[model samples]
Target: MQLIRSILAAPLLRSRIASIAQLRRTFSSSTSVSARAFKYVVSRRVKQKPAKKTNFWVKQHLKTGRRIKYPPYPYGDSNIFKRSNRGLFGGKFPMQGHSVSSELEKKNLRRWLPNANKTTLYSSVLKKRIRLHVVASVMKTIKKEGGLDNYLTKDKPARIKELGPRGWRLRYAVLLRLKEQEAKRLRGR
Candidate 1:
């Protein structure tokens, strides 16, 4: 009772007690802000790390050290492999650009299509004939690799890129056939 009497006697303590009671009432009913209440404030001038710049295409060009005339289609957008099933142009796509002949002449847009020919390629491993439309460059590569089997089985990045979907499927089939043949030979022995 004396402590309560002493608290009531002090003007500042009395006002503080009254404010706390009012604050409790306000909190029970609705949200309220008091002058004495502590608040968490976020600083606007807080330091942040800058985002790193990435020049992917520039890096690729620098690594190759050659300007690419034709770039492969984005495989992420759709199944590029399915589209390449028609004819394997070694991942080459038709390029369309404006061709300017003279300084005063208007730009003429033209589509340059690769020369694809239907050719028969023999795979010594699978012992079968494959007839498909292929570009001259692909044919030259197959010849250089010795045969279709070697061309398909080679794990080179350039060769894999040129293979496309049809070649990839053919490689799997050839591998399975080779495995079966090996098993048969072992059984005979």
Candidate 2:
């Protein structure tokens, strides 16, 4: 009777051990899965650097190496009273704190002023006031050449040589400008 009971107990003990082993395997797998998910969440929550804001004026100044000063007045200031002097001449004349001739010389204004109309001059002034160096340079070149037609017809090779390898780019831009101006004029009429 004792031997039979011992044999039965041994098989029962083996079965119990197998069940415990299965439980341990299941628990370990579940814990490992949870640990991996926790690690993923922690990685995702890590702080990132904020994006920097670029100022147009500063960028233009840097690119062109020009000293583009801000206007004396604030952005929202009323130009009604000040318009009499500044508006008539388009502020191209000398003022209390600003010298138009000096500004023009600094920006190489002679290249464009001969061909510029009131509209063109006004637009150029706006660009300069805003400190857009790239547009200002393009405007000056385009105006100096007296439109795309003149540039293309006058001397293709000579102009190209004078402008170096990138002359084609300037020609393309001038052509686009001409088309845009023509479209605008047609619309206005």
Candidate 3:
């Protein structure tokens, strides 16, 4: 029984050595692989690659027009404006400041929230009226751009970057609608 156990243990030890030898040959002999990668392999530590930056939602929305979850704000991310989606503030978010009291000379933290009014915006491209909570700045910009449709469909980087998830979805919807109309018009002709 002792002899049999020794025989089994000898092969197991040899197999372990064989595996190590294979690993050394696989890594050390490959000039294409780096020494750091070989060290990671020997240590059994996996080197994770960095995540690629992508506009995944924009691509997917344009391709499939599928429902997308609200992603993080692209610019000036602040947790204070929790209800940013509830209103279009044009780039203005809630501001935090110290409010001084005259009587005690105490500096208190205060947040100045933008006033959002319920308003209706007409979209000529979509032929629809959208009721939304909008701030004065956003309303002014929309009017300046000629209408809500123009504002949403603008290809400027600043405009695209500042648009939150809700705005992005709305923009894509309007774009798809416009494309469909154009295709139909072309087909008729």
- TM-score: model 1 vs. ground truth: 0.53
Tens digits of per-residue lDDT, candidate 2, 21-138, equal 8888754544655355454444346688798654333333423576444333222232433322212121122223322465455432232221213332322211222211123333
Give the alpha-carbon lDDT of every model. 0.67, 0.40, 0.71
- Each candidate's TM vs. the true structure? 0.53, 0.22, 0.56
Q: After superposition, how far is residue 33 of candidate 3 from its true place, in Å?
A: 82
**Tens digit per residue, CA lDDT, model 1, 97-185:** 98887877889999877768899877777566777788888888878978878777887776666677566666666665677689889
lDDT of 3: 0.71
Q: Count the backbone clashes (under 3 Å) in each candidate.
A: 0, 0, 0
What stretches of model 1 exceed 4 Å from their correct place? 1-83, 102-104
* Native-referenced Cα lDDT, model 1: 0.67
Stretches of candidate 3 exceeding 4 Å from the true structure = 1-80
lDDT of 3 at 141: 87
Encode model 3's per-residue lDDT on 1-189: one tens digit a residue: 998778657977879878888888754555653335544445456889898653333343534666544444456443656566555666668788999999999999999888778898877876767777788888888889899888999998888765655576678767777887899899999
* Candidate with the larger lDDT of 1 and 3: 3
Candidate 1 lDDT trough over 10 residues, lowest sum: 54-63
